[model samples]
Target: MVAFDRPHGMTPPQAQWELPFFNQHHHTLALGLADWAGAQRVDESDDRRACREWVHKLGEAGWLRYCVPAAHGGALDKLDSRALVILRETLAFHSPLADFAFAMQGLGSGSITLGGSDAQREQRLRAVANGAQIAAFALSEPEAGSDVAGMKTSARQADGGWVLDGSKTWISNGGLADFYVVFAKTTPDAGARGISAFVVPADAPGLDTSEHIDVMAPHPLATLKFTNCRVGADALVGTVDGGFKLAMQTLDIFRASVAAAALGMARRAFAEAVAHARQRKMFGQHLADFQLTQARLGEMSALIDAAAMLTYRAAWMRDESPTQGAGTPAYTAAAAAAKLTATENAQRVIDMAVQMFGGRGVRVGEVVEHLYRDIRSLRIYEGASEVQLLILGKAALKT
Candidate 1:
């Protein structure tokens, strides 16, 4: 039995989240979420069904309320970045699918909260906050994965409305979401400045989602095609040429939480490694007795510490950073650093934990095995590690 009180040198690995960066509310939120997540035995068999169920469960528990503001179905007066970080971190530790479900709700409706008209906020964000609706963020297209400016998806003015015609692939909650926050090119000649955002219901007349995507760690992904999908003038979100900035703003807030989720997965793997090392023995001594094992454990602990601190700093700074409701240079760079470091470190840490677990680690249904697969996508999604490096390098050059 491990002492959670952290008396003297008896601190568990999870005690790291209790660092000075967090306040009473943050601590309370983490402890409460830990209890809730621990009690949940997840079944992620049907990616679509599992995502829907997770969303339902999260909504029922009132945790989904944290995704929006209090005035329109939320627990806080504003979108609390720190609270979001804690929630994602805890949920990811238990079930990555759960984290994905919870995250898309926030990501899908984030633009509305930041830039939506009052009516749009009520139309989407309120429903999203209550778990009455599932939300999807649709920004990536077949020709435009990392390069947002290269998107071929366009929304043209017609009949006092707009007609969206193109495809968006690799969309989270694509087939499962009740509504999608879609970014389209309104000015075909203006490049990135030409983009616009819209709130498209899943049942929209011209939308099709027959194409399903199977990923290594699946949680409801698909390709969306809009064949002359028309929407009224009211469906537009934010300014006509401001979708890129809106999307960036939305991502900037959640990017640090991605790091936090990675941190949580890394923490779980570290705990399992510690438990296994202490119990397993070799050459008439426990595995923890070996010098090399001790060295590896020490190194793992150090990596976790570095990642946690960076993630925490990034999250808090995001909450505090001032900007034009777009994004801050300081926060943007910090978020990129945190995401880059945490996801890459999680991959390494989980790999080491699997190695320590020996044959059991690679076997199907093993915790470490799931973690290995789960961590791989984080490095690729949100923004690839290479893209993060470019962001950091560019930020450095400007500074």
Candidate 2:
């Protein structure tokens, strides 16, 4: 039995969030969430509904409050790195879909939480925190995967509001989100500086979810089309031409959390593999007795520990950076490093677990199989490994 001191009555702990970087409060939160998630079951059928349900559960449990500010019903005045780490690790341990559900709420509404006016925060963030609404971050376009400046989504001046006309592809929670924080180009000639952000409600006229992209993981994802979708002047987030920086900064804060989620998945898979090795015997000896198997297990543990350190360090650097509001070059570099290392190492760790399972690993319904699928998108999303490498190289050259 696990020694996790869960509050009141809770289930077994799958994985704890305790680390040298986390504080006592973070440790308590991690233990509680891990216990809670361990008791929950993931329904593979209707993954969208499952994700929505998970969001509601997280909200009811008061975990969703970390997505917003205290003035707007959140637990903290701003998003805290440690809280994010704890939440992601716990949610991911239960179900990656659940983690995605909780994460998009923060990603989709983070801009407003960081730079929105009081009215926007009250209207959007409060409802989101209360689970009365779901949120989406619409930044990727059909043509602009990693290159934000190349996006063609346009926002033109209008009588009472701005008219958005374009399409965003591969948006997480696209078909499910109650609202989206969309980025559009307001000035054609100014390039990236021409972009602006807007809070587009799901019921906004002329907005349509054109298509749902079926992925291997089978969560809610879609392409959103805005054909002359008009939003009020007050819907503009932050300042015109400042959306790019805001989006980048928002991503910087959450990137390490993505790594943390990946790490949790790796940790679960590793534990399962280890258990299997110890329980399963081959050639009159347990699989754990094999020298090669032991070596693989040792390597997997080392990789997971290293990934955890890098991921936590990145989150800590963001929280402790000198420039509170503006993004710091140092923090940016550290975050990129963490994202790069954690994602790549998660891939390795998951692969090792899959290998350890041998033929059973390739089975369609196996836990290792599910993890294999869950981890693929982590590398591509947020920022790709190649992209992170380039970002780090550019930062180093500048220094």
Candidate 3:
């Protein structure tokens, strides 16, 4: 059977998976966060309340400080992609909610970091990094999730401001965020080019999130209704009629981070499977004694490593690329490739781990069971696996 003997000194699992693309600084962060995450377990009994508490805890512990730039009181000079990768992978290894809280702080306010005016960044980015406020990305709607241009929501210019009229659903941190980066149509017939982004405070009049959305994996989500919701001219984020581009650009960086999150879940499942294989017995012999079990374990290990390599490579390339350049063709393709391979592979790895656990795996609260639920949504969100394929295909054909 495959075996791993850890070194005498402390070794975070993140360190063991390190690539040459990352430096000692990355490994150090992984070790620190791995220890921190193992200690802070949030209660999921109340998903909404628990998410709030988790965000506060993560901020208080300083992990959320990497979400923005040093100009706005962040730890890093800018949003470091590799650092984001390590943080998400380590946190997800311990708790998916924790990773979610951390990721939203980055993604929800990502457009602001990339294109916000100086005052806008000063107003929101620092608070986000400090976790003084929760952030939400409000892009998907009832009918416009994958087909963004199909959105019916409109932001009409009114009284030196814009009045938002429509709804957004399936939004993470929906009912709980301090602010949302909302995307809407500014010009009715201009297609993607007419869309614009706005920073709408949760307290904006007419904004409603009374409907709590339930999913297979428990988390805080809701449908937001913005009937005549209005905000000042200063609330516009990035360029007017540039919302679609901004949304895509924001997702580009976080896409690889999503892959990192999946990798963590995959790693945890592998560890559980390995431990079980050594202890489980059948036919008067250990489960590891069976050739079938060995083969299953082998495949699981290979897939996990392959996913890690892809995820790390993608993250490294994105970080190496210039900032404010997330929409560049090369970076977009790399991000798409990593997200596709890692999330899909993670699902397979987690499923195999559940199979190895036999009947115990399907039990409601088993780690594998929870991971199984947690990983399914990854393949569907942040650009689905099919979407990633089209992106890569377009790039390949062009080359």
Could you say which candidate leads in lDDT? 3
Off by over 4 Å in 2: 1-18, 323-326
Residues forming the 10-long window of minimal summed lDDT in candidate 1: 1-10
Clashes of each: 0, 0, 0
Candidate 1 wrong stretches, greater than 4 Å: 1-14, 321-326
Return the lDDT, model 3, position 306. 84
- Per-residue CA lDDT of model 3 for 1-399, tens digit only, reads 001112123223754546797988887887777666655656776778878887888888888888988999798888888899999887777678778889999999899999899999999988887789999999999999899998989999899999999999999999899999999999989989999999999999979988889999888899999999999999999899999988987898799999999998898888888878888988999988999989998998888788888788777887775752355788888888889999999999999999999999999878888899999999999899999999999999999
Supply the TM-score for candidate 1.
Answer: 0.94
Model 2: residue 206 alpha-carbon error in angstroms:
0.7
For each candidate in turn, the TM-score is 0.94, 0.94, 0.95
List pairs with backbone clashes in candidate 2: none
lDDT of candidate model 2 versus the reference: 0.83
Winner by lDDT between candidate 3 and candidate 2 = 3
Poorest lDDT segment (10 consecutive residues) of candidate 3? 1-10
Per-residue lDDT of 173 in model 3: 95
lDDT of 2 by residue, 40-72 (tens): 655657877877887887788888898988999
